[model samples]
Target: MSNKAQVLVIDDEPQIRKLLEITLESNGYEVSLAATAKEGIIIAANHPPDAIILDLGLPDESGHEVLIKLREWYINPVIILSVQSNEDDIVKALDNGANDYLVKPFRTGELLARIRSSLRIKISEENNPLITCGEMEFNLSARIVKKNNIIIKLTATEYTLISLMVKNEGKVLTHQYLLREVWGPGYINQSQYLRVFIAQLRKKIENDANHPEYIITESGVGYRFVCKE
Candidate 1:
């Protein structure tokens, strides 16, 4: 069996597909290509990739719909690579379960970095109690969080919020979802409440609260946690 991680590229544009294939292959990944949503779904179902590069525009069906269906069973990372840069489209895709989103005309270096981040997060989800990102470390079982080997004090709500975000590193957590998970169903509409808590979490975890490195604001959406590396 090949040790290389596999990446499935689903895009209608022949040039984009070709480019991705070459780029991914040269970077030590196995590549699969699909031009339409139907074909992509079939391929993914048969041989699930370690990660997916999905385009939002497809010939047979909407890529968003394809992402929704794939999320039903495929647990691996799904990164949306779309021309649609609108906030609504980005939010919808993230809420529908995309692991990450990169607008088209993206630099290959950045795309590679996103893929690496997604793959690393997926590989780290192996029922391990300890999760480490940059200087921060989390002990899920003991409910302890540390920065640079020193324990950091956090309130109950703050710990819960940080734990949730850490567990979902590299994926966007929408305002509604974050509120519902951390606060409850009643707080789904309370974006301000979420913002305040996020700010608090950043102050505790980030090196600079004003320019946070870990908890990133998605802008008009929610937040995404990323390890600074």
Candidate 2:
């Protein structure tokens, strides 16, 4: 019921937790700190935060395991904070369900920016129950898509992809971004997955799959969902 967005920082390092607490609080956020993974999970389940900044290296368990468990029920953004800078580690964490990643010794400005961006999207998704554009309509709360007032069936993956694109309508979502959001960062290199899914989506929503008016491909870049505001 507090107007300010609540953030939970789950990290063992006191310095990191203090820094995050100060930064997030100064930015008008209600902050909570958990030094262990078990404590983080318990606090989260008891009082869910608007966003979470989780460290990969935890004393009790791997942050990856924690992220997986949170994603099983927690829908809010969970940004990974770690010292691992390798591409494989970044991709692995993302694939496991992290919303974003920030390496250790990170810039506070960028961290705030990522949190703001993620929270903005989450807020939109939660508040907007129905979205209309051209012949298509999305019942975001129900996870339902319809065209011309007729219900259209979609696989969970497809729905996830389309919903992401739709939520970010008119923005050209890069292949890496879409892949990270859809199949996780591990699939960032899998361009074919996007192509196949895009094709299937077009077949279902577009009047002519060959010439789609809703989902536009950026040719070597990514895809964008075009709609009238």
The CA lDDT of each predicted structure is: 0.89, 0.86
Off by over 4 Å in 2: 126-229
Structural similarity to truth (TM-score) of each candidate: 0.90, 0.61
- Compared with the true structure, what per-residue lDDT tens digits does model 1 show for residues 42-74? 999999899999999898899899999999999
User: Model 2 compared with the native: what TM-score?
Assistant: 0.61
Highest lDDT against the true fold, candidate = 1
Q: Cα deviation in Å at residue 66, candidate 2?
A: 0.2
Clashing pairs in 2: none
Lowest lDDT sum, 10 consecutive residues, model 1, at 82-91
